[model samples]
Target chain A: MKQEIQVKCSKGNLALIRDFVNRWLDEQEVKGVLANQIVLAIDEACSNCMIHHHNCDGRSKIEVGLNYEGETIYVEIKDSGKAFPIDQYKPQAINDIIRKRNKGGMGIYLINQIMDEIEIEQQNDHFIYKFAKHLG
Target chain B: MEIKQEKQNSYISLAPIGDLDANSSLEMDECIQDWLEKGESNFHIDGQELKYISSAGIGVFISHLDEIRARGGKIIFSHLSASVFDVFKLLGLTEIVTIVKEGAEIAPHF
Candidate 1:
């Protein structure tokens, strides 16, 4: 199955993105903890794109694409905003994060923990963040 | 997100309803700040109506943990939906924070 959604780059749209992904996951019969993890990962990626790349500018847009093939599920987020190198980021240790009392840095960390594979593709005019998870 | 607040004994209870994402988390952060300004420290997060949470949502608690603890107070969570609890576990928060299981009393942790 394949599905896609386009959302405005605004913090207010984060809930909309989650709802869209959740509905698609539900239609695919993806339930339980695995489904929740996938939804969280997608939310983190899009949140990063909107906040860091587009600065939560409502004029910008991000496209979310989903595909389920065999035992793997693939997610792709495409946008024309500045690309953030999520794949190269080294997450801080949980203990260090607690010591620093940081609030905003954990989104990328959670995304890395939940997604099995992550890649960033820069095309001629846009960038795509690809995240995949294999069903056990 | 709507957070219902109540003072129960020595702790302040905040029950956040609906999804707590980046947008709504700001409200929860501000609410906590307000209580802290009033010298209130101990917190009990009733997650019964909290259906969903993201890293930003959890960040609210993480950011305040040190200050709350410095004031000799604690924050305890209870009645989290399975999915919400999974998010906590996935982030390794269950190790550092107190998560009271459903049907479990919060007094011990609080």
Candidate 2:
């Protein structure tokens, strides 16, 4: 089954996005811990879109797509703003972040830890972030 | 979201109930800022009721840590749920931030 959820680029709308993804995952009978992890990952993805690509304007729009096929769950987040610049991106060590008390890197870190495979692409006028997870 | 504030002699505890996402993170900051203005230094976040927190929520704590420390004050956390604790652990926040566990009181953390 496939479902799509859409929200404005505002941080104010993040709660609604989290709820929508959670409810959809719950219906797919995803376990609680795994479901919560995915919810976090999805939220981080949208946040990156809103903050980095759209300049956190909240005026632009973001869309998320959820699909369940066999034992895998796929989530895709699309933003129509500027293309995502992922070059030269590398996750820092956990100890380094702690020592520096960095606030910004945790979102991408959490997404990497929670999601199994992530693929980024650009098509037409939109940039897409796709996340895949496997059920236990 | 519901936030319960407990004022004690040595410390003030602010427990945020429900998901501490981007929206509630702002609310949490406002409440903490109010306490800071009132000359409340020691703060402990009772995380037992907080089932979830996003990166934005974590940012709130980071944004306030230095100010609290500059005044010889402390902002601590306690009784985090497993999932919430995992985020703290993952970010290595437990290293720089004081996290009270094993049923310990918040006062000793500060």
Winning candidate number (TM-score): 1
Backbone collision count in every prediction?
Answer: 0, 0
Tell me model 2's lDDT, rounded to 2 decimals.
Answer: 0.82
RMSD of 2: 2.6
lDDT of 1: 0.90
Candidate 2 lDDT over B1-110, as tens digits, reads 89999998899999999988866787988898899999988998999789789988888788777778788999888888877887877677777788888588667666
**Cα distance off (Å), candidate 1, residue A27:** 1.3
Residue B7 lDDT (model 2): 97
> Which residue pairs in candidate 2 collide?
none
Give me the runs in candidate 2 sitting further than 4 Å from their true place: A55-59, A86-88, A92-103
